[model samples]
Target chain A: MPPTEDPDAISKTPPEPPAPLAFDRPAFHQQAAPEFACALCGAGLTGQYYQANGAPVCSDCRWKAEHESGPPQAGRVGRFGKAALYGLGAAAAGTLVYFLVLWGTGYEIGLIAILVGWMVGKAVFSGSGGVGGRAYQLLAMGLTYVSICASYAPMVVQGLREAQAAETTAGAGAPEGADAAQGSSSVTRSGSTESFVRMAPNGEPDSQPLTQEEMQAALPLPDDPEQMQPGQTYKVDLASSEEELSPALSLVVFTVVVAVIALAAPFLGGLENIFGLFIIAFGLFEAWKHAARPAILFEGPFSAGAAEATRAPALPEAAEAHGE
Target chain B: MASSADVRSPAPGASHCPACGCESPAARLLCPRCGALLHRRRLEELAAQATQAEAADRWGEAAGLWREALALLPPGSQQHQDVGRRAAEAARKAPASLLDQPPGGAGKMPKILGSLGAVGVALWKLKFVAVFLLTKAKFLLLGLSKGGTLLTMLLSFGVYWAAFGWWFAAGLVISIYIHEMGHVAALRRLGVKASAPMFVPGLGAVIRLREAPADSLEDAEVGLAGPIWGLGAAAACWAVFLATGSGAWGAIAKLGAWINLFNLLPFWQLDGARGFRALDRQQRWLAAAFVVCAFVLSGEGMLLLIAAVGAWNAWRSDATTPNWRILATYLGLIAALSWLAVRVVPMPT
Candidate 1:
């Protein structure tokens, strides 16, 4: 029932307002009946209230009322469209996940935030991967990537220097295999590959592509001398850089450039610590680059880890060949 | 309790328009006794003229020359009006003029921003309850900052009754009118014919230029004319407070600085809004970062939150201005100034 003009309608208030009327009531009701039509937009409305000062203002006008500036003019609705929307949603979801992860696992969500932003930016504005479209994605990715990396520069420099100092001290008291492996690797040329070999408990080649059975064979019986627990490392070996570590000093310049750009944006919202700064910085730079040429900023997706496993080199076979 | 519209619009140049003629401090601009260029000099023309004058010894001729320019016209003249609008416009464009004024243009964008933001704030505020009178008043007052009659804060407190109650409303009138006056002064200083304050609902206040400035440099100053004009008003307030020992004037001074600073925040829907379109991308990014940091520190998370939403909308934010660079300098100056003031003059005592 339309709201009766009677103030007595307060006494006659229905159990509850009719379910929220769609913004356009005329179209909805006119599909079958008569109802209040929006004075401006012609959209229909329910629970239309016609005051003495004016005609019935519907939910549509009401919504417009709620927002005074109104949406952007018909043509320039907003600065962003799909990309901004995607990034905003992604950021929101990513932030939510970080909050949840912090709640569950006490680990920082900073790293994940980096990936979230990258994805959001990439989603709306295609990364360099797209054959077409202005190179906006690449530029944005580059700026953001540089910015994120910059956030950790000061700490990384400090950490790396500390690590090098410890390595020098530890080298004096080295385990036998470490130095020899290092020496061999150093002896290799630019394209030369180095490999490490592992001996089976029984001194076998141990190259049967370790299924659970072969994996179990490498382990001793539970009651025997050598059994490892589930998911535990089995003879792990860490790799050293075939080349000397890329000079940490040089990266500082690139990092600073990113830091400056990140700090420059008007919306430099920081997240959990590292990722937030990086994301905000990246977003700002990306926005900046796009504002400029836009074509130079695009970059395609390039995560080596994301590649299929089959496509990756066969590590075990190579290790075994070295052993033979 | 009387309807303010009842106050006559002052006899056209007989005594003068409200701002220049009336004893009421609320008036900011007045009708020219005879100055009529009606054709405001676009900001671009002013810039072109200012450029032409630069090689000459213009600086040496500043005061006398400016006074001569001002004599060509007259002092000029809103609210729910905002605080910073007048001061920022004045500080930025102290020598507001038409011949010397740049085309500080954005089409209808700023108005849209103001209207949308105001409406959003109102809706959110009234989300708790919706009654006819409540919602009607909400709609009516939502974007009334540019509504003129609502602005009257800068008026003498004794005239609060005349202001129709509510400082935001009164201040809107006083701040906007005074701000426009700053523009009139600047334009006159450049010998550019300019209009008195022109009121626009929701967008606050503006001074129309009736003619262009004599040169390019004048135009640049004219582009900055509005801000300088408003700043001059603030300086006047500051000086009065110091000399007269008026605590109320002190309050106005504090508000003036802060409001101007806020307007120049280099964000959406503010004076910086103009800067957004004009600055480069790198500048904008840096400015964005500064703004976010400032908001977080100032506890304006809601703005950030809204910006997050805006970011989403502007994900395609094709902002191609050196906004960040301009913002960096302006905000840095404002922040430094604010800090110095706080240290030297405790805020509202």
Candidate 2:
């Protein structure tokens, strides 16, 4: 009889080594069956069951346990569209809050606007609850820009109106003092939120000395001695030809520059919003990172003897062939 | 097989034990005889007997004795590995008749090839990940370090200008560059090895320290240097504003002061936290008060973030022992910055 027929010798032979384990770790084995639920998903494992981490696991969960990276994400388009809408809502809300702050404080708080961008990112990511791609990031940024423009519109419109009014009043030959005083007063009074600082003619811009005739014409001295002291020094505005000649060129340049700036404000803003958008993207990336589920683990249930049977070559057949 | 001699302990009157030659009394569970653990001594004796058997070419006896020695030693320890290796060697070299196996085996090539194939497949599967890691390492280890500091600064300036506008971006880049240079200068003065400033595109500049600070005080000095230099640059900007009477220069000066002050906020990875290492508990409280007041007066949302981060750090930094002299210097600097801020935006000229 073959050595296999001898039960004693068969029992004495060592079990085949466990199959080379994945992740370069030692093999796992199950000693006995469990009378409880699946360790991975808490499902009631009935009849034949797989062992995972020394506990019973259902076949479905067993597959997931073997594949540790979790399942591929589902529904890319739907999630991103929802995220975009949420970002839009956040942007609108942020801008409204920014404008309110600007109104209350009489100063544009840019850092607060950046906070809005961050919040918009957080809101959008949470609303979607999925990994976002580049397109989704772009969409968030686009909405941020919309918010920035919307907030700045009221301020920009006010600045434009004041600039136009100042130009017309200057055209109407308002005294240099009146024009300078009025422009400065309007800027300070309106509380324009544009951070665009313009180089307007501050104070009196190095005026030429006035003639006695021009001084008399400029300010009519009060006849009463009580109202005006005889020794009081008086300064007058002079319409110098040289000053007028230079102003035409300077005014043209100034107007052109201001107009160019007014036109390019939105473009420059869009550029800055790129950085803001990048910030929002970073926040969204962080939010999206947490959406992945942890991987489950599975252990095999085969006895040591059974495991040996699976791994060993067909020994009886090979031995018979060798005997032949 | 343990004989009577091997099992027996030395007599109490014996001056010294034979095994380790330690003088001790006999008839103890532990080694009053040799100062060796009784159980451990037996294992060691067994190992010695195994070595003798192996020298005498008694393979089976050596293998069995080595196995006993292995069981007594900690798993994965040097002794365990040595004993296990000797046992395996004895088993392999045992006579074919005793081992019940054919000698001079030659059929292992297929198994060896199978292992090689498995390794190849693993490498193939991990190719993408390997390439990705290699690329990242290349950028970090080689790319940034290759260029001169000035070139890197220029590149950083270009990036900043592209991101922020020319008017705002230039001043900001110069300000940040100056700040990082301050760190480099402080590091040099303290005889610490450090690299020149390297600027990140959207973020600011940083100087890589080749060596760590000698102590918290040294660290505070290195940290304090950045803001001091920055404050100087800002003061210079204020001077330009004074000379030119340009509102743009005034704005830049104000921004410089505000940024330097903000960097003084005590928080992780900020200049403030490192500088805060120099402060005692009272000074920390004073610094906190100052930051709070500055935030309230500034209405800057960035300051709010800094304060939040700073407060969190302060809560967590209980382990740091403070240096009072550094605190006084830091406070003096803060006072100077405050004065500069007032001068920079002195009521509307």
Candidate 3:
């Protein structure tokens, strides 16, 4: 049998948008919500299943709470994990930039790269950290950033420099006026032993002589051409013996060593950098922990959390849906 | 009648109200925590975030947060209206102005172009990974980025280089932190809620704010906050430079002056940008033009003139800025002072 609709029932029915529950009341009927409060901090739950009831509470609480649960846990050395990650990232970025400078604008400028590193550090971290003051922390970070760049950049720069020098040596030869078209010195090697090679400004035999030992060290005896480091000065002496011979560079690998030295300095000043890194990790960790710990505003706090935790397993059949 | 009702009712949502523990008969609830009418959790969601203000140094994030927080407030409430007004004020203010920018704004165009370039990079990375896996799975080296920057085995060069890095890094860290602390000082004076500066990996520190200020007072103070530290640091650095009789002092002084000057720019990310936006718009455009031109022209005049035109487009953007024009104007005066100081620094050999 078709049941006739009750006109009064339909008409009397309201057409309001469904009301959201007043947060003052409890969420579930009677039986306390399953683990509605955080077990560790006793912070009340929000949403479904175990989240702080609108307050931030989590491992940070855990960090604070670590005092009670036994001996304070010392953090692991992290196998230098965080440092390695950040350092690598910085190095790669620096290297790319160094290469870009060379490739793009031929900006072989060094300090600008250093400045850029500081700028990058400023952009990334906004200059905070360290024991003494904000500037010190910025210095540390800037150094870290610049050093990272120093670490990766020289390799490419060194490689390019070596490549360019190699090309010059390879193209050293042309006859007569062609070689002297510009004031360039042309070097010729001796047979077998590469003993007593000569370098004349325009291919004259009367030239500077490099001792056999110096020749072996700077030049690969009979095969490899001599390589020069950047920022090095080598003087080819015409009558130079092994004892007297001095190359354009007094020392090999000067720029590379200097950069490495700069990068390594931050580690020695203090252990503050490590602590600063921990802060970074902790901050990031807090951001992650936010999902679990809802930002709950404090209003005495106990009535909300304590009730949910302690009042569970009690019976209130008539008052099933209501709670403070 | 109002008194009796109030006495029995115990003001709703009042943090001190005893009746707050009881069930509410009304459909709308009041927040015992904040003494606010509990419309929905979403409204206060921004303040709920710990890092929104913490990472305010992030230009994009800081602006986004202020805007988002403004949107969340109920439009008509006093506080809501306040936020709306401030946000509207910020909007009315010019961020960094492009008017003074050198004609073509070489720097900004490069930056914009550079930002667009990241897309190509992402695509290339995807292609590289795909091809690597498809061609030779064994050759694919994932997690290589986690490896060291060749730190373990010190090359003869690396050992010396590390020492150099140690000194400079220490000095720079000190300078950077000191600069940031000045910001903290200003913020604390203004009674803004801010966390101690957190260290960023391979970067600098940032203080977090809990919420946007209802008025521009706090914002202006906060905006002005950072430069004081920078100036102090520069002064100190220069002092050291002088005491040591090192030529580097000139460079350091110049840098400090420049940092102060550049920060005064009326842009969103830079401190100057914040200051300029805090004031009214008329000054914002003027200050922006001044900054862009001064910076570009001072550093690379020819390039700046060309870049100024490009910067004009960024200046022309009428989007809402959080700061006002007064900050920019004041900052300009400071910049002029610093510029004079920097100009006096002897050129390095």
Best model per lDDT: 2
C-alpha displacement of A98 in model 1, angstroms? Answer: 26
Residue A112 in candidate 2 has what lDDT?
49
For TM-score, candidate 2 versus 3, the one ahead is 2
Q: For residues A96-162, what per-residue lDDT tens digits would candidate 2 score against the true structure?
A: 7777656544556454445565656666665566444445555665566556556656556678779
- Least lDDT summed over 10 consecutive residues: which range in candidate 2 chain A? A21-30
Cα lDDT tens digits, model 3, B254-333, are 56555454454444455655554455545455554664555444552322322343255346656454344454545444
lDDT of 1 at B202: 29
TM-score of 3: 0.36
lDDT tens per residue, model 1, A1-324: 885576786777766521221110011111222123445455543332221112233444444443432222332223345444544555456556555544543434344434544555555453222211333454444444543444444545565578777765654342344434442311111222222223354543333232333222333223332453543213221234334446786587656654565444323433213324433454544444432322211111111111111221133532333232
Better of 2 and 3 by DockQ: 2
Worst 10 residues of 2 chain B by lDDT: B1-10
The CAPRI classification for model 3 reads as incorrect
Ranking of all predicted structures according to lDDT, beginning with the best and ending with the worst = 2, 3, 1
Q: Write the per-residue lDDT of candidate 2 for residues B14-94, one digit (tens) a residue.
A: 222233333222222222211223245566578778778988998867766766655554343334444556666665455
TM-score of chain A of 1: 0.23
Each prediction's TM-score against the native? 0.26, 0.40, 0.36
A best-first ranking of the candidates according to their DockQ comes to 2, 3, 1
Q: Provide backbone clash counts, one per model.
A: 137, 1, 98
lDDT for B275 (candidate 2)? 83
